[model samples]
Target: METGPISAILDTTLAIIFTWVGYKTAAIVWKYTPYSYPNARINAMEAKLLSEQRFNELAESRTLQNFVVNLEDTDYRDYLTGISTYNVEEIERSLERALAGTYELMIKILPGRVSPFFRLMLEEWDVRNVTSVVKAKFRGEPASDYVMEIGPMLPKVKAMAEAKSPEEMLVILEGTPYEGPYQRLLLGEISIQEFETELYRMHYGKLLSYALSKKNDERVILEEFVRLRIDRTNILTVLRAKAAGMDSEKIKSLVIPGGSVKLDPLIHVEDLSMALAELDSTRYGKVIRDVREEVEKDLSVLERALDKYILERMGELTRFYPLSVATPLGYILKREREIRKLRAIAKLIEDGVEPERIKELVGDVA
Candidate 1:
């Protein structure tokens, strides 16, 4: 039977639609299937994450010795058991080694195809390593005896550790995307805070760009996660700048380009208190608002809020794609919170800050 032109067009359109649906379904299945075994291990790891109660118990310890004894009761035991003293550096290196172990495990278990995304995620840690070395160099301190020593960024980290000063560090970073910001720092055109802000922009920009390039479940989750982080960074940056009495224009200048919020309203205000007030309507405002009084008392509270916010967002995304990259990534992010919060507790102990105060502040994460 001869069909009319409209009927033939409808048939072709239906065929195309069905083909796209089938292709997408297959792609999703393919993307997630390889992660099944990796995620089972991830699930086991996630199940072992420190409960709020445990963090509290550790925080309640009366001395650094007590905290170490308490820590020996958890998964951190294997990583920290050798530590006899409570030095902050000793604690940080042990915690970071545990983290480095996780990163290595993930890189090994992850399907080869998924390496780039995971590697990009590790860039955040690399940024921290570089900053740590830079600050140590400025203080005339020796390079950190401990570096993560993993991932493709290892060479860069090694080079940074070898540099004797910030200028030397800038020379190592030259020709990389991060060079301009560090150079500006060396030339006194930008503060370390501003330089760190640029590192974050470059990191998220790289992750978001790659996430946008892929067409899959992982991309959807990653893209959303990256943009959420960008928003978090912008929010905190604006708030801190305003509090510092930075010029309104200069405050805006530090705003990263690809965030999810319309922060212009929050960033444009000259008054710190007013700028924070303007934050009431943004997506991440609740974190700051929930701890408003504390944030007012100590600006560091906002930093902790944002870190928890970022980790919470990762957990939420992991639930959305139960069998994908988000699962392992979630474990890594949560473990990081555990490590960072632990570091804070150790630092407090080293400073002779009371355990009750530590429990009050550093016990758990959002």
Candidate 2:
């Protein structure tokens, strides 16, 4: 068995040759196979064909049945959950959580590459919550404790800083990112009107800026929504000021400059209450129409009427734009509606109001 060095080298070369031959044969077989890299064009065509067929099938089945099937197949079970017979407090809590879940899903599904217009609404909600908490803290009211944590402005810090009067709070906010409105607050000088104007300006300015930055259909919808809301807000502001016996000039000063109702006509009137009626006759005539008797009795009724009117308009918008930013905006509205309904229900139920009455006062079932 003792082999010479040349013989051993020859054996090794033969082994190497056989290994290379086997590899080459395997490569040739693989190349000629149906599902191999060399047949990549066919594979790609087949994949495309399959995808088209599936898409056609989906298109054909795009009905309630398919929707139900998709819901069953996905993590959408909770969306279908309903509150039928729960007590008022329980129903309120459940709806709040559901609304929160809706927003969470919205934030999840919104594309990372989306324009900022789609996010303007959520931004407004955040700012509103933060500003409310700040104002409440300055008033030394308990409302500060209920601030939602998701607001853009740091509420806790702002609340702590605004623990003094609103004037002091405005000074505290100076030189920060929110300083512009704070400066305007000092100049506009609505001491008797309170700083509600400043808050409105700050929040709406943020929304307006965000909306203007985008140039598309989404931006159009969002901007319209903001404009409508601001108009309604100005109406409420004027009505409230008139009811409170504030002078016409002061009330006009509080009006946001670009709203539907002009301050020029409003400032000319001597009687603030009469001015409010004239203003309503022209602009918000419809909302105050049915409540005219109530307004004559007490202007406070007009404020509630305006609130309901605003909600109705917002509800319509929600219906119109379900798949857009309007959906999440609807969630916020729904949550607020639930909270108000619960508060109303709690007070009425304690008064022994019938369940039927409770339901009627709140709304129809979803």
Candidate 3:
């Protein structure tokens, strides 16, 4: 045999071995990782929760009292029963407590390595708490009761909660991820709404950075999910801004970058129809097209459609990739939506909102 042929054969064999080893190592790492995800159980639970019967039962609830009674047999019974009163405000607070408790439980059950993702997800709660505190501080009202206790940012939230003034809160936020948003607020560079939007932008930026650093199949899935989320968010922002009659520049400023959908055309559109037309060629085109009639009925319809789209996609991912991060993440997202649906139903019931209207607001089962 020629020496060149022999060398080529050996090189090819070594390459195959290395590739096999790399794949095996990755699989082992994923399987043995510290996440401790209860993937199968969570997926099963999600399936049960979204079943048609369960959704109809929830949608047909006649009153907040009735809803609470119906929840007696579900995991939410305790949380709903914890409400001291049937008033909207009390019900809302109890719902927050329930959400916080759920997050805390998730954090406790998940491994430390995987906990960061949940913690990051919980940062929205932290942001809401902080916003409440800052507003209350400015208005000279008590806010400590509004601070949530279920995120990696809890310690900072607590400190900010204690701050006597917005200025003090800003000082506390210094050197943190939130500092820039607060600084912009302090300098009159952005409105309160803009500040909140910026905070969300920052949160998603961090999430994207974390996903990219993983450099694995899980990361690819997560990045796609995050990008879709960003795109939906941008679309909603555009629609809302148009409804509010915001100037083009302001609307453009609110559009977050890095979404899979190109937003440039939509952002500059003079009207909602124009924006929808721009979205006609994107991956989400069909979603917006299907909801166009509903959108004409009320712009809020897009919000509901976007949410449904995201959940549907997540459900698909979980079903196809049961062993991946998709399972647990999909469960978490669906669970959160369930909680929101319950809260909305309770609030609507308290307000004597019609069952049909409430059903519309709650949207599809998931």
lDDT by candidate, in order shown: 0.78, 0.53, 0.74
Clashing pairs in 1: none
- Local error of candidate 3 at residue 65 (angstroms): 3.3
Q: Supply candidate 2's per-residue lDDT for 129.
A: 56
Instruction: Assess every candidate by TM-score.
Output: 0.80, 0.55, 0.83
The per-prediction CA RMSD against the true structure, in angstroms, equals: 4.7, 18.5, 4.3
Give one digit per residue, the lDDT tens place, for model 3 in 260-327: 88777877778877888888898878888988977866876777777778878877876676566676
Global CA lDDT computed for model 1: 0.78
- TM-score of model 3 (CA atoms): 0.83
lDDT of 2 by residue, 274-328 (tens): 6666766565777777777767667656666765665666567656644444444
Of 1 and 2, the candidate ahead on lDDT is 1
Shift of residue 324 alpha carbon in model 3, Å: 0.4
Residue 99, candidate 1: alpha-carbon lDDT:
87
Best by TM-score: 3
- Which residue pairs in model 2 clash with each other? none
Against the true structure, candidate 1 reaches a TM-score of 0.80
